[model samples]
Target: MQTPDQIWNDADLPTRRLAGLALNPSAPQDVLLRLLADGPLAVRMVLCRDRILPDAVVDAVIEHPDTYTRSFFARNPHVDPAQRARLIDDPEWFVRAHLAEGPRMPSPARPKPLPDEAIVHMISTYEDENMGSLGFYQQISTGLRRSLHTHPVAKVRCWGVGRWSGLSADARAALLADPDADVRERAQRHERYEDPACMERELPARPCHGRTDILLNRALSRAVVDGVLTAPAREDERATIAANPSLPTDVVVLLAADPDPEVRRRIASRADLGPDERRGLAVDPDPKVRLAVSVHPELSEKERAAIDYEVPMDCGFTFRHAPEVPPAPEAVRRDALSAHPLLRRKAAGDHSLPPDLVARLAADEDLGVRVLLAQNHPHAPAPLLLRSFLEYTGRERAHLTTRPNFPTTGLAAFADHEDPEVRALVALDPETGPATVERLTRDPDPAVRAALARHPNLPPPRLAELLDDEELAHVAAANPAWDADTIRRLAAAPLDGRT
Candidate 1:
């Protein structure tokens, strides 16, 4: 029953400091304003840069005596145009220079376009690459697209041949005769592909689902339903067809009796089932089918009350929360509590479960299960998270230390953990104080030092030291604290050279 502010106030100095820094810009406005007023200088500096802070916070930060503090508030997006114009003539040259950058200071650099050959490789080699989407391809200018058609690289020409709508007969012949196999293949594929939209509009009269052309037509007409039905159904395709919301009711009913349990499971999830079908599926032989029926939207509240179903917590229905009616029968809750370690672990992740269940799972015998409970459960005890960090080993311990909400009460102990991985995790944790991060900069493990270099809260002086490390330079180049000029210098430096 303790309030967030009370909990925050009771925490040790280190814990309170870390909690302040770890708060996202989106933290409730009242808490952020309180931290800005009473928190330590480091906490206040972080709040000054938060772009979403209310105008009141912005006004206060801009008036701070320290020029460096005022400079940060100047760059924040929350500053109004009037404040921005005032900063233009401020005594601090840094503030004025940054304000002069534009209405938006620290403007993000526009990405340089990829080289033509690189663009070709991106589209021709990877279908899943988002740049290869139809909308992006359509945006290319006709003149620039024509240049690609005749580009010196065969891959570029191959990509062009696939998309060029106005290819001449002679040009198609020449492409087919091209020595590159990719170019010839692309030309042939385009020649054969009639757009699916053509079939959707033109083939309305045809049996939609069964025909090969209907497979090409993504149109959701009656023809598509007939094709899905009349076509010799493949087992792999049946599950997808069963899940399609647009499928005719008769086809959905037919799929309910599908020999494949997965297809039947999919059918049970459909939203348009009748009362009889819901009742019939409620007693299905497959436990998964019955579970799906229990939670199906089509199952009425009246029907749900009438059924004598014993639904387990592991089912997707109640994975995140328990059901209201029947209130997760006592027997089901007991089974979840005593189930195999795996089920108990899953049950612990359900935030709506009683606090006692979460506590039990947190202390479970299996380290992996306990780790899951610690990382996932909202009510997972803080002492439990801290204990795992101290006693456990491997990635689980590392995971506990890196959690943004990881209790910082005993955080200092792990900052010097003999395990380099735990030290690295602590160094990376936003909640770890600057002193610990500074200590870890000299950590024996280079990887730990590298992680410290990536910490957003790293001071500029510490970051400059990280730049001197050849191995950490690439990672350090990505830090937002450095201005464009500094980044350019960093990028221009040889990869093998020290700062």
Candidate 2:
């Protein structure tokens, strides 16, 4: 039972290889360093796979010549900004693509310019592939505008307009009327024409779409107050506002008070709206408008309480922030309890609600309301929570089991609960013993067996027992630890025979 560090320092290759398997954070730093340096390339590859490795170690292996080694660094969450920049230009396309697509890659300090040589090469070789790769069709088009106009290749110029319009109005207008049909078609498709007459010149001061739009428009009127309309014309102003989300606070305040309910609703939905705008919407005449404000993530509990009187039965907005709302005062809680069933259900979901209130709601006579409380209520005792779900029959049982955090404790008792969902949950529980998994391997439902087979805690012996079950065998084969011997044995076993 040598420790990982002891094994790492051992002179033998086998010991060094075994040390690579111990990747926990507590493994000695020198052990990791040794693995990074002198260990076999395969062992170094495994060490690089660990995301929690020290920064020094990660940096050292990031440039490792092995493609998989470099990829491991590219995908490592802890790879620093400097390493990301290096990987972005990696010779391997897969590594570069991985860096480009990974969310953890730090945004480049300066936009990487499409190099003249590369741009030329791309124009010569890949110009006809797709508009997407030329970097012009996507929103916030940049980097390709200049090259498209003056490239040595006309096809590249034509492809460029098909992808991006020049920033200069005159250049754009000329390109719009270019002889090439592809160029003209793309300009027309994205409405990038430079001529004012080609597009809608005037828009409403406050354009309202459907009912939802009207509420958003109203919220904007109240939130925006100054330079509320700053465009060349009022219509242009409205269009500009719609296009850009950076409207000034004064403008947002003015827009929040607009007569249109949709305008108000849109403003309420904006995460950028300030406290003043939110407070105003909370008291809006329209219940839907008030409901929008009530559920806003930034609205304080006091603001939420102030709008409680206007909660709408038809909308789920009030319940959206149930996880964040502070505990309502006793009087308010009682009022909420006495409200319509839907309102009671909404209140029960409030994570801040007193446990007693949730406990009381768990006992409500209406099964739907009780189920809602059980699923939404964050603090209900485990046993009571399980009992509440057990009471559901038919479709109700199916609905209850779909909740993401359905209780796992009483699952075995309900293994035979007529509903497949209940049995599926039981089989899926990681805590289910090998014996339970063995029993479930023969479950009448294929989904139940699949769930049991995939459980992380399924014993190797139990997994061996299912070698002959086709679906179960497939699941067992997919496990990372499934070795060549296991696969060969499973393949040779008779279809319905257990080992």
Candidate 3:
């Protein structure tokens, strides 16, 4: 029944600082391991889930007695997937479920898929305890997906029912006749969607996630497509089916000329467009439609270049999963050098771009291109990372600061900038002098004030002043500049969480 704040504060006010202490970059190994082993759950939560751990601590977490502790690492993005997969056979179901859910942040770049053997083994024998996370698991690799329908294990094969649209006819038939009754039952269920009568009977009458799922994904026979199109109410309803991929060629032709521009936009991205359909959609009245068609797989660079698409200067780009087979270098060069900015933006996403190409795109005129390069390229120069951080206001902006080569010393130059967020960057730079650090202590923005409060180089008097400022106490105490005696006392505090 103890409150989290009460538990933290009753141990002494400094115990409330333990969460911040766990993230202190200069916190030593012995201190981190102690926090891991004996700290309160809140402290351990920060320690295990947020940063890379040393070998000894990783070993401890791998065998941690706490189920939540093990699961925390299951979704930790900083740890390698191979290390995270060590929990696939965990004694607890929640841990395995967490591993199945993949990383919390899947964009910028998703982590590598879990090992194929671990994936196959988990699906074959593990009971998901009704979490249903197994079905929505995102760590699946393309190679594993291709092999799913033929995996030696029947449960793994049965699991492929969800991917029925991608399976070969022979594979589907083999599944339909498999010795395992469950496998046959699943395959039959998927096969039933192919029947127009069943599709009609099961269709949810109104808009809902399930109806949208069926419209966009489940098999739709021409009869149902025609019936829905004939009886349709909203243009979005038609738009949903326009993107179904299972839509008949007739439906594709029908929707391409439909009264709604959104429907046309949805149809434009489909890869199967006949050459004429592709060309017509390219010049569609809707600029969004033309933009969608510009990147269709069938368009050559020259063909895409002719579209009058307007690339949004500040619009953010979404990242696709790393393709199973990487794009060839020559093809990437083609896109990177293409006249169209969208193609160049698409090429900016290839993580393996050679250094000269990364440097070239880093300075590209487009906001999305520079941000994409900063987000994906490991070798993105410090200046690009800094400039992207300054210019970009996306949720991913802070992630830019953590990139390799994000400048540390030279950022003191930004101290007096008009924008407080830009000025806040100077607060964290190790090279910012004591004078600027002192000046920033009173910056109009509380975020700037708090940021400089945590700088280890903040003048000792100011650091002490902020420590007792209730709003800044926890952050100030977290600073690694504290002398040896203070750190030892904070580290050695009994964290049993008993009053």
Best by lDDT: 3
**Model 3 lDDT at residue 395:** 57
After the best TM-score superposition of candidate 1, give how far the Cα of residue 331 lies from its true spot, in angstroms. Answer: 27
Report every candidate's CA lDDT.
0.56, 0.52, 0.77
Model 2: what TM-score?
0.38
Q: Which lDDT tens digits does candidate 2 get at residues 33-128? A: 655665554455446643466766766776566665566565454434345445655677666544433323221112233334444444454424
Off by over 4 Å in 1: 1-227, 233-235, 283-288, 300-425, 428-448, 454-468, 474-499
> RMSD of model 3, in Å?
4.5
Model 2 worst lDDT run, 10 consecutive residues: 316-325
Error of 3 at 223 (Å): 1.5
Whole-model lDDT, candidate 1?
0.56
Task: Give per-residue CA lDDT, model 3, range 215-300, as digits (tens).
Answer: 77778877678767888545578988987867888779878887899999998989877788888989899999999999887788
Ranking by TM-score: 3, 2, 1
Model 3's number of clashes is 0
lDDT score for residue 91 of model 2 = 74
Query: Which 10 consecutive positions of candidate 3 have the poorest summed lDDT?
Result: 1-10
